[model samples]
Target: MTDSRFSCVLFDLDGTLVDTAPDLTGALNHVLSQHNLAPFSVQKVRNTVGFGARITIERSFAHYGKTLSEDALDLAHAQFLAHYSENICKNSTLFPGVDTVLEDFKSNGIRMSVCTNKTENLSLDLLEQIGVSHYFSSICGSDTVPNKKPHPDHIFSAINRAGGITEESILIGDSMADVESARAAGIPVIVMRYGYTAIPSDELGADLVLDAFSQIPQALRDLSH
Candidate 1:
């Protein structure tokens, strides 16, 4: 295996590391059902992700041409979370090549962390349920940091919490939020072409654009040069 260029690698949990849209869409549909609204398909819901559960709830509701009041949104958010937590891992799986890539990093003495917009406890629960929690030295979420992604603090906090230095750190993610955050934080970022995003992954302007997780080690090697 090729050596990694970074001392620390921070991954965005949902799209970058795991394919979580199935369960997330299931949770969203459960909430919509309670309100007698139409449910969204997994493909449609994929682009709505990356912000957080509350935003997901909002976007799903808007899809039905319904605007939710703050109180209604709060209720829907609570309902979505309850249903989601119960079935968080029912269909979630690590992306192809994730395990091998993680193993390579581990064996190479590179530190790793999960930096996600999901809530802290939920991110922890999902990571554990998906059986990859042990690979990460730190798992930071939107709620765990002072600010969420698109704000550099989310990246900084995740790296710092993992005892990683900014100079030797890199981010792997699938969204514009990740690009903006890493750029603002002054670090290189790699984006996955197969991840969930409203914008095209290649158009996201990352340092590297990968078609599969297996491409990561080679990409890291290229970046190091």
Candidate 2:
């Protein structure tokens, strides 16, 4: 638990900071209903969301007992974007204790940034809609770089934008993509236990795994010491 090296905290937007499952599920259900497919349960949607928009849509279609053709995929993708865009924050919210943890970091002079697999525009829109856009000094999304997470480019870009490097940063997320990306970038990672992760949180191989967002500040303190 060595945190002295971490001066900046980089977050993954969708599953890490924001509970975007509701809006995402709504959009998916909209598409499903249009195609005469059954809507999925929230738990099912939650389990399928961390992979990014295309994967989410693909999984949603699969769950509805349908395989999307290229044209159908494109149409569903468009509908999802439009639907989610309009309702991005209507049901989306920061995970519990997220604000307290973020404020604690800011109070301690730690810089913060967002590094997500979502498109830059949608990420910003969602962050702003959720009213936490001002907390981060940098926000890098999939479109911001040539490659997305598991590649480390987006994380590095965020670190750079935050005026730091991997040695002075940590990525807090709930997915294997975050863990692997931070590992590739040579940064420590803290994974939240209660987010939309693909596998068990411990299996992500993060430097630290926390059960709650409220525990983050203490976890960071432990790491720093």
Candidate 3:
């Protein structure tokens, strides 16, 4: 195995680190059904997975020719969160090779953290439930910092919380927000091609595009140079 490119690696939580769509779809559908909207398929909802819960609920409503008032949206959002918190990991699973890749990074002395748009409490809960919380020294969520991703501070804060230096860190994620944030932070990004990104991964302008978790170490090495 080649030496890794980055001393620290930051990952995105939702579609990048885990397949969270099943439970998310359930949550979205739960809210939609409450509003008398048709339920969406897991596949249909998976397309919007990484965006966040409010947007997901909004999109689900769009499916049924309805729009919520801010008050209704807030109420629906609360209900979605409540239902989601109860079933957060019911059908979620780490992507193929994730555990193995993490173990390899650990053995290689690579510090890791999560920089996700999910709320801090939910992010932590999901990671704990899935038994991967220990792998990340820090897990910074959308609410963990003053601003969220596409904002460099979110990534910088995550790096800081992980005791990682920016010069030796890189982000591994799956969306345009991840790309832009890493760029603004002056770090290279490696995007997961299989993630739930609405656009093609290549268009995210990452330093390296990854087809699988196993490609990460090598991609890091290649990009670091």
Q: Pick the candidate with the highest lDDT.
A: 1
**CA lDDT of every candidate:** 0.91, 0.84, 0.88
How would you encode candidate 2's per-residue C-alpha lDDT over 26-65 as one tens digit per residue?
Answer: 9889988898888877667777876578888888777667
Task: Enumerate residue pairs that collide in model 2.
Answer: 2-223, 3-223, 3-224
lDDT per residue (tens digit) for residues 186-216 in model 1: 9999999999999989899999999999998
Pairs in clash, predicted candidate 1: none
Best TM-score among the predictions, by candidate number = 1
Model 2 bad stretches (over 4 Å): 1-3
The TM-score obtained by model 2 is 0.93
Question: Which ranking of candidates, highest TM-score first?
Answer: 1, 3, 2
lDDT tens digits by residue: candidate 3, 7-90: 889999888889998999888888888867778888787677666788778877876788889999999999999999999999
Model 3 global lDDT (CA atoms, 0 to 1): 0.88
- TM-score: which is higher, 2 or 3? 3
